[model samples]
Target: MNFDELLSHYKAKACIVSVEFFPDGTYGNIRVVAGNKAHCDDMASLNHPFEPGCPYEACFPKNPNFEEHCYCCVHEGKPLHAYVDLYMMGLWLNMFLLPLDSDQENIGYCIYCYDVTPKADSSAMADLSADTAADVLKACIKLRGSGDIKHAFQDVVEDIRQICGSDHCCILLTDDEKCTCSIFAESLRRGSSLYPMARYIEGFYTITETWPGTLAGSTCIILKDERDMDKLREQNPVWSASLDYAGVKSVVLFPLRHGGKLLGYMWALNFNIDDVIKIKETLELTTFFIASEIASYKLLNKLEVMSTIDSLTGIKNRNVMNNYVDQIVEGQVPMPKAVLFADLNGLKRVNDEQGHVAGDKMLRKAASILQSIFHDGEVFRAGGDEFMVLVSEIDESEAQRRIDQVHYLSKITDDVRFSIGLSYGEMDIRAAMRHADECMYADKNAYYMANPELKYR
Candidate 1:
């Protein structure tokens, strides 16, 4: 069909309200405005099949045959496509075909697609504008709730590519330590042969120590400027080689950020720009939204870590220790464990006579001894003046030997001391703790009886 016939067919399909394809392929210029009001205003200067260069230039460099142009392409002289698929997200059934041109002068075509949401025909344009904004917000939330931040962005990029009919989409995450970026995830069209690197740590966007401009290096657009983009391409041999292998000609990278901190960039690559515009626009909103949500989730994880762990000592806190034992007993983890109950001796006397500072030092010293002796088992500060150790795989003999070692060390240093009572059993962790406590108290009473002058309380 000729241009007019093609346009008529799409308009009737209702997927497109008006379609125009120009011989210069700049027909996208004549297509009415699309996307949200913000985006439409941001991109108002150019028609469809947006060529390389600034949007303000007029009349195709004043050429004799193509001199009527008021907007220019960003690529200057490269081929472009400007068709808008009216059927994005299965939301719209109306199609409008506007052919810009049919000859070499036609850089590309522009399509103003419509959606199926039943607003009045006159208000259809307004509906299309608002629908994308709402959908983008929802998609952003859905991705954040998925839990895996990297994978969620990858999924969104892929979904956007599918909606926009692109060949492939991928995301590059920045590695601050390495001062570089790498592809973390990608989604390629079914038949298209685009495959990104396996992981992000390998530096995929580099050249063999040369000035970049090969397809690989060209892909990294450090900033938005296209001038130094060639330098980025020249530096990445792997990326350049991969792009050539996959026949990818056009690419758009959307940098993701959270509170102005750069998280990474999402890239949409296709043989044509039209195939990726929708994805680019959709990701623009989704990226920031996803970043902010992920930041919040990670902060919560950090807080949880800090709360569950004891700062002065590396072992579990008393509260956490109780829960740990409860879980092991209630869930029936395994057999063969020991319970050790220990208390610091002479601490009250040390604080009363030598000052609390000395007593604190002695307690810390005693804690260190326990930690060093029972490093393999769970050690806990069960109370202000008491501590506990729970072990498995050793019997009463071994436990006693370990206790003797602590006793001998205390005699030599005379800095601090502990009296430990031990018990071993398969079940009833709580009862075992009680048994150890009872034994500990009996030992204390015996010591006091033998040396009444040494007793402090």
Candidate 2:
């Protein structure tokens, strides 16, 4: 359409206009007054009419809804006329009109198009914000349920990045024993100098210097410089490596807490304030909530560890042994496997001659010996004077040789000796155990028959 006519048509609409196209197809700086739909329709029909001979006729169709003219000549990705057509369509409906090129062939349309209608209600933005928060909360809950403090922190880092619109996130956990810290997670960027997935650290000075609270639970430290960083790294090796690994000069640590105690701290890295709202307050609150979940997970993990471990020997207990065997018999445990049974021979002699204290010593010493001999196996005290072994990838013949070595060595110590019975193969472990026990009794009898004086009565 002619510049003056198009201008007069849209003048009354008060729509913002920054660019206009002239009859010569060149861009022109233009301003216009607003108008009603009829005025716009009249202007389109007068100048850029829907006639055969019009140069701009390629853009305007006989659409009654066509409003003020808008030329998309500025978008050089496609033909100028096609862009103009799309731009004119957009003006009519307040919608997106992506132009396409004919050379696209089999690749489908070259341009993308969409119609964007103004949201009638602003509350949808609020709903979107709430929905995002809920999703982040659910993700944090899933991470916490994993029973891994490190993994939970990692998931929180990613969640925070999504919520905060940042490029990366991380978790820094304070070591209660060493008073040091480490990087638990980060944006899985791969590089030798990048943030190592598992690194110990102290504190990031950027957030900590202005943090106003203890470093243990500090959040959102924007790295401003290197002055305080040296002091932090000097405090611990873990701190130094974590900082270098995360490639983040600025960091925030949120202490995971539960039941009025601090469980661990999470870290967020590479701050992007533009994407996430209230980078500090939002992250702090989010971390606080996540900490409780992480704490519960850590507690469960500790309980699991305690359940499987023998307090005295620091190995799997009888309960663990039985459970492990069930797994092995079912072929759930990885093949190949074997079992060893060991009995301490002269415990009564030790109790009678050297007293109960000596007997206890003998038991502990025997356990130690068994541990050393079967270091490759999972060793356990099955009961008094008895032990069990679960060996992976070793048959009974190989196990018998190892037992002979242990037995031959016992001759060097006159005070304590042992009669060990071994059963191998992928047979029933309980029945194999019974066979080993009978064999051990047979050996014990042979030893007493050879030397009655050596027998403990």
Candidate 3:
């Protein structure tokens, strides 16, 4: 073959790749045997001058996925294409491979071409084969059309499992700050021996922490056979041993990331290795949408928490308390057997003598003490320096004992004194709140009568 003539006809970073064929159906020494001028320029720009028959790693990074694609293209005699995010380089790569005629018996050849862009092109990403496009589009519709997000996630994971012909599929979310990982959704094929991920969730984050290093700048990890597993054992022994113990022979793992932050991981265990390329293509696109959805879901949850929680004291705010009251009034919720009102005795004195900062600290301390004592009840920051506790079921004796304990605990914390009043036994919650307020004022009056020097209007 006139390799130079073959090279002169092309334009966009094209090169001829040769793979050494073996009798045992394995490959060795993938090399870039020839290149067009554009490809040579690319190599020169990377400080690696073009050398015929140089190892593929001489110019590009060593990626197992790339190697697999090259081997498959040469042996299978088919064209292949992939659009991948090169996160380490902050680039998106659109690549293609086409098998070439080779006269030699011991070597197979293919032409590889690619283009790079700083950001993803949606059209290029959507240019998928009909089957892959249908599969990915179905997942997208399920994600966007469902009101129940958790159920939608379950359905999508099961779809992925079926598509991959795998024993199990799982989406695991990670919290690096807490060093914890949770199974967001998972589907296991019936009769499969794999245990549910929940059983190992106790310290799985430690294993998850090792994944980035094992991936080693690639976007995913695909262990298709024993050779790949051998490489994984060298890269990550702990995870490899865990997979071996779990009876996982083949797996595909992709990280769920949005805006450069890693949200979690999606993986399939014991998948059909014959369709590795198809599975990789499907998951690459599917996880992009999944990560975006998960990020939005997390943001909404955080906003809801902010709205319902007291910012200063970290307790339920008055808004949530009002909603609970409405539920009780509507008979949607059972009436509490006990209601207690606790008013800070001398917040104004603290603010006047020291500062509002000190008064704020005192309020937080008071809220903490109330939370510790009424752990079984609903504690709310009802008003400025006032808190309310509602117990769904408590006898009068136990209520009085808790009230006495609160008084004693407050007395010991000289800076945090409370005028507490309790209404025990089932009644209209509205009436209980009013009675508790009046009793609280009466207790405040008694405290002032005993210690007039510390009293404030």
Candidate 4:
């Protein structure tokens, strides 16, 4: 066959790929047998001049996913198309593969054509088979239509598991700063022996960190058989051993990314190998929407925390304290067992003598002492140099012990003193707060009477 002539018909960069076929349905060497002008130009630009019958890796990076596609296209005598993010290259690739008629025995041939862009093209991504399009659309609807994002993610993961005919599907979120990974959502096939991912999540981020290296610049990882698993073993022995222990045979893993940030990863275990292309196609688009939604959800949570958290003291702010009081007043929540008001005894003197920076440090020290003592309670910054601690489901004796501990700790710290007042037993939250405030003032007056030299209004 005139391979170059065949490739000349494609305006996009195109090449002829030949695979060494075997009788047992396995392949040997895969090589780039020929290339058109555009493909040759690309190779030359990379300093790897086009050579006939060179191993595919000579011209392009070695990718197990690409090898699988070539083998499948040649064996099945069908066409394959894919739109993938080449994250390593910072490019999006639109690729097409079509089986070609071959004359040689024990050899198969296919035409691999592709184009690249610096950014994702929505039309190229949406170009999918009807069934795949429907599946992706369903996932998008589930992600965007639900108010509870976590529950919506659960539904989508289950749907993805069923679509892949897999035993398990999971979305694992990664925190690089904390070096931790958490299962965002997961679905396990009924009666499957596969254990939940939560069992292995402890210290799993170390294993996840190795995935990008194993993927080797591909968009995702697909291990359809033992041969691919062997490659994975060579690439990541620790993760492979963990999978072996967990009884995972075949798997597909995709990194969920949004706005150039890696949010997490999505994976399926023991899926139907015959539907690899369909599964890849469906997830390629579905993960895009999922990552976007996850980014939005995380941003909203950060905003909520900023609004309700004290920036300086690193405790709940007055807004949250007010809301809790409202909840208790309206009978929406149980009355707290104890309320304690802690006012810094000499903040005004410290600010006037030393400056506001020193005063701020004193306030932080006070908050830290209160937090350490009432670690089980809600600690709030009610006002400048003032903090509130609310504890529920605790006996009066325990509350008093905690308050005593607070006083002892504060007394021992340098230049740190607290005039603390406590109200124990169930009562109206407003009245409890008023009583605590008055008691705190009385304690403050006593402190000033004892140390008039340090007193300031």
Candidate 5:
């Protein structure tokens, strides 16, 4: 029952460790309670062997920011065959933990360690290091750059396409909402004319919804040839049909995940090799880093959009306006510009007669009108009932056309009542803004005077 006696009966490589569980479902302190001399010699980082209450994780040197796989074994009560490489020791350790039967409520874990260092140089790791470097460099250049996302990702996909012996590779970035998952970006194969599987994008079986029969839900779904495709067809007819129609004899899909959420799926079609080992090895080498880059890009993009857009009207807000003015005024993007200042009429009347909800619809209507009129320019929801359009590098005829379009559209509906004031020429952004703002107020004053009841507005 004592530590030394318990250690004697187990394998020479085995160790007993105590792991403290936190309320957040994550393990905290991992202390090695007992181990054989051989286990201590290998695992113990210091000159002297670790005492009963010593940090297990720190003692085992690992990659920085490395998540311990042993946590899942102890906390989730799931048995796993996982290994960790102690870079300093150059020894790979395989872990197995069992729940200890102790009087104490939280006695922590009793782990068994087995070193698999001899098997580290197996043929399965064949050419992985050599292959990854070439792919990683090319992928990093494409993903990290400011090139168009699809185009950049397409280039990244191309690196893996031929490397993995695939005819085509594409990354489909997906957006998951409450009841649906939609493809946000499709980095399709280069020189491909039509999308034979385009129907599935807008069809019955979306990726996540159709494929939920895996451990991580991000598991690789590999279909080799017609029978394999047919088997999937019965499971999800639409998805299978689409795949078959595309004339893809073989396919492999790996879900690109960040944290635990699936961002999208990277897929390869009709590769030369059906050898699962090669396919898995190739994808395993590439998909992870690619997925991480994709996740960072998407999260950053979402943040940018949230900062720039008006949530209600779905138009560019003051944040965008500030950036636009700063660029033009600072001479960053020099061009002849036009500032069309627009204000909605009867917004106050609607807010007073009907509540703010109705007023919101009126504001949306006003924003829609502005967006329609100034389709070519950057339209901003400047204020509660105000809009501003910034058109850069515009000539007189183009400027007149934009202004004329606004004048003609304002008379279309009683609900969309608004006044527009434009200042267009080779001028500074601030001066144009000021002139347009003044003209807008002058136009507003004329409307108010005509309708005396709304004189205050």
Candidate 6:
């Protein structure tokens, strides 16, 4: 297409917004004259593919700024310019109203719009009129400002269901660790036969043949109606079966994404969004932010787990033990009525003779043995091949019995042997720790004496 051809195509295809105004500076209905197709081909380039004969109020629904802007141009009798940022529409529009001479001498103005959002979301258009965009933002703000902000996906979906007027709203969260899609939230038609609410509350669903999506390599999918069922089924048979059973007629899903990474999927059922363009624009505003928040939440949780857990033994680490000690010091815990320190035997030998991998296996096995004996107590991987158990509210007799059981189990196993030192009825944590450490060494010496073949540095 050459320049003139392209210009002609643009003039005919570009979204053109117009409104008639009264001489008193009041405006009549804003209408779509032409160029709605130009609005859909690219997101940032245009706006509402306004249906013919639709009022401006319908486009911005419930908002009067569009009319007022046109009225300003009519009163000025010259081209007037304005800037509007349609955030939810993913549009930063530079709008210009050119005064037009009408036959009846009534005032009229035409709008020229251009999108200004960053290029990340260029593939889609947020053809939401300014009013609709404002409504979407207010809902988002309400969600963010709710006094008792619920981090649950349910809260967000419920909020969206209201704004989108969908029969149902659902969110599926990605559990990367388990590679599963857990139903995070759902706000369905209260009595809808489609996937009764109970199914969503049934915990996680595995990411298998039963799920949906073939990773369309895109961020959004709109299933207008039954016509799209074939592709939907082709992508995920299991998901298709569930949808069919639920009596679902239509679906609109957006991949909760960040920087091209899909965090999960949020969708609306039976919505038939009156203006498909606006829904796309509205989601383009919220879904990615939702994805980013969830991603951050997961990252923080993973970091918390890593900080307090021992990767090799899958038990609390020294940091946790220190916290426990601090709790005792602060009287948060009852000074740990009993303290037991245990050290694995022959770990150095295992590491030297076999390998670090074997040593890791041995360490894990030893930790398990310690955990099994002190099942009722708090266990910690205090150091390399060393474990600690702090038992509170336990009588001396019970503590002794548990220790004897540990000794009996240790004697029955050759590889999973450890020395334990117990200090019972100790109110001062420091005294118990010292006494227990000394006792552990004494036991370690005796074990070596009995089994010289297992002696090590």
What overall lDDT goes with each candidate model?
Answer: 0.54, 0.52, 0.92, 0.91, 0.66, 0.67
Compose the digit string of candidate 6's lDDT tens values, residues 43-77.
33346444545565444434333454565555556
Cα lDDT tens digits for candidate 2, 1-457: 2324433444332122223445544343332222244434555766633222232224324321121123341223321111111222222122222233323222111111212232222232222235555765676576656666667666666667665554455655444555555555666433324444444233443332332243422223333235335645665445546566556554444555445454555555555533222454355446555665656656787898788876655666788877877887787976435666778888888888889888877777777777777778888777777788778877667787778877866666665678776666746777877777787778778878888887875
Which 10 consecutive positions of candidate 2 have the poorest summed lDDT? Answer: 79-88
- Backbone steric clashes in candidate 1, count: 63
Per-residue lDDT of model 5, residues 252-368, tens digit only? 777776666777777778776434435554575466667878788778889988999999999999988888789877888764478778888888878888888998987887788
Q: What TM-score fits each model?
A: 0.49, 0.56, 0.94, 0.92, 0.61, 0.67
TM-score, prediction 3: 0.94
* Candidate 1 per-residue C-alpha lDDT over 196-311 given as tens digits, one digit per residue, 9 for 90 to 100: 54533355534322222222212122212232334345656465565555565655554555554556666666634443333433554455465566567557867876666555
**Model 1: ten consecutive residues of lowest lDDT:** 59-68
Q: In model 4, which regions exceed 4 Å deviation?
A: 348-361, 392-401, 423-428
List model 3 lDDT by residue over 1-457, tens digit each: 9887987988898999998878877788999999999999998998899999999999688987888889889888989999998888889999999999889887889999998999989998898989999999999999999999999999999999999999999999999998999999999999999988987889989999999998887878999889889988987999999999989999899999888899999999999999999999999989989999999999999999999999999999999999999999999999999999999999999999999999999999999999988899999999899999999878889888888888888888869999988888747899999999999999999999999998887
Candidate 4 C-alpha lDDT tens digits along 39-79: 99999998989999999999888887788889889988989
Misplaced by over 4 Å in model 1 are 1-229, 233-256, 260-276, 328-336, 344-376, 383-385, 398-417, 441-457
lDDT measured at residue 104 in model 1 versus the true structure, 0 to 100: 40
What is the RMSD, in Å, between candidate 6 and the native fold over all Cα? 10.4
Write out the backbone clash pairs for model 6.
13-35, 14-35, 15-35, 43-124, 43-125, 194-246
